[model samples]
Target: MAQMTIAEALREALREEMIRDERVFCIGEDIGIRGGWGGAFTVTLGLEKVARERVIDTPISENGLFGVALGAAIMGLRPVADVQYGDFLFNAMDQVANHIAKIRYMSGGKIKVPLVMRAPVGATGRGAQHAQNLEATFLTIPGIKIVCPATAYDAKGLLKAAIRDDSPVLMFEHKLLYGSKGARSESGAVDASSDIPDEDYVVSIGKGIVRREGADVTIVGTLLMMHLALQAADRLAQEGISAEVIDPRSLVPFDWELLEESVRKTSRLVVVAEGPKTGGIGSEIAATVSERMMDYLTAPIQRVASPDIPVPFSPVMENFYRPDVDRICGAARKTIGD
Candidate 1:
């Protein structure tokens, strides 16, 4: 067993995958350079050592880079494309949503786009553009699997799974959760580093991991919000109110059975998200739960999310805009009739 940061864990996953599969390679901006930032957060740092040709770096062109990756994937190559910011995914939406996502289904299952798009999300005081939570935008499109890894272990495992999966996968890593070192470090970064086993393992996609178990209510979150939910759960524990924290690692092929079971046991649900309340991922989850298991719930499904307005530029307003542990705890307490 060894301790590693989320960035290191992701790098390990890529390193192992490239070694295991000849078809697996990386394509992004500033990746594979001698002393680059490693695709924005240093996840691809030092990968040029083993597979320089496989680690391809391109210009600052999201659309062109994604187009290249999609073309490569169509030719039976596993291409992992990295975007500096999750928000920039909009630049390549056509290639991602139209071509990459629909190619397999449109071709009547004749093609397999085994491509992984890695993007860093979350409001790390990066103003409006870079701070937006882009998960909701992608959740609308079909055929692409979405995953948000919350810890170093999950980062390694889920990334391995994403790389191996036949369909196109979108992995959204939170900027604050990367535990990135040096100049790329985020100011509000939480220590998402974890002790990872040296043995090879893969966390199944579409599975939710229970970070903390409780009886009062189930708090569903992903990415950085999952960490905040855990913190809120700890604070709730001090008040004699138990809170169960669930990280839905994969969004598209979500573990609904697991979430339903948790909701059935807790009889209450509070979904916390950094995205906007309207048409957000949290809204989808809450609606699905209410539609399927309304009878099993003792309280209404509450969502604690950012306001619909753009993320504020001021740090004071930004902190207020993003959902915090206090907001999550308050929502959970209200859901459980505390």
Candidate 2:
């Protein structure tokens, strides 16, 4: 067994995948350079050593890089593209939404875009531009698959799964959960580092893992917020309230069945997120629960999320903007009529 940070785990997965499959390659900005910051978060550090030609660094053109990746994928090459920040995904929206996502279906299954786009998201006092929970944005797109890994083990497993899948996949890694070192360290970083096994492993996408089980209320969260929800569940335990925490690691092929079962047992639901309250993944999950399990719910579905305003620069304001354990606990309490 070896301990590794989430960033290192992701790099190992990419390295192994590229070695295992020649068609798999990496294309991102500053990733293959000798003395670069490893694509903004050090996830691709040292990858140039083993696969120099496969780890292709690009200019600062996100659209151009994505277009190149889509073209390469259409030609039967697997390209793992990285965006410096999740917010910059807007720069390549056309390539991701219209081209990479729909290319397979539009081609009548004649082609497959085996592309994996990685983005780092979360409000870590970086103001608004660099801080965004992008799950909601990609969930609206039809053909793109979405996976968010919260732990080092999941980071390695899910990245491998995304690379092997035939459809285009978007993997969003939270800044606070990346365990990034050096100058790229994020504020409020959790101990998401884990011990990885020597043998190869892959976590299946579209499955929900229950971090904690309880009978009182179901708390659903993803990425950084999932950690906060677990803390909230622990705090609620002292107050005689049992809370079940569910992490829907994959958003596109969401494990709704697991959530429905949790709601049926708990009879209450609380969804927490780092994104805006309006039209976020939390809102969509809440609406789905209401539509599918209205009779099973004892209280109305509630969501704890950041406000619609831009993420602020002040530390105090940023802390308030992001969902915290106290906020998650409050939402769970309200859901259970506490």
Clashes of each: 0, 0
Residue-level lDDT tens digits of model 1 in 97-149: 88999989989999989999999998888799998888988889999899999
Q: Which regions in candidate 2 have their CA more than 4 angstroms from the true location?
A: none
In candidate 1, position 286 carries an lDDT of 93
lDDT of each: 0.91, 0.91
Q: Candidate 1 — number of clashing residue pairs?
A: 0
Q: Clashing pairs in model 2?
A: none
What are the models' TM-scores?
0.98, 0.98
In the range 240-334, model 2's lDDT, one tens digit per residue, is 99999999999989999999998899999999989889999888999999899899988988899999988998999999899999999998888
After superposing candidate 1, which stretches have Cα over 4 Å from the reference?
Answer: none
Model 1 scores worst on lDDT over the 10 consecutive residues at 31-40
Please give the TM-score that candidate 1 achieves against the real structure.
Answer: 0.98
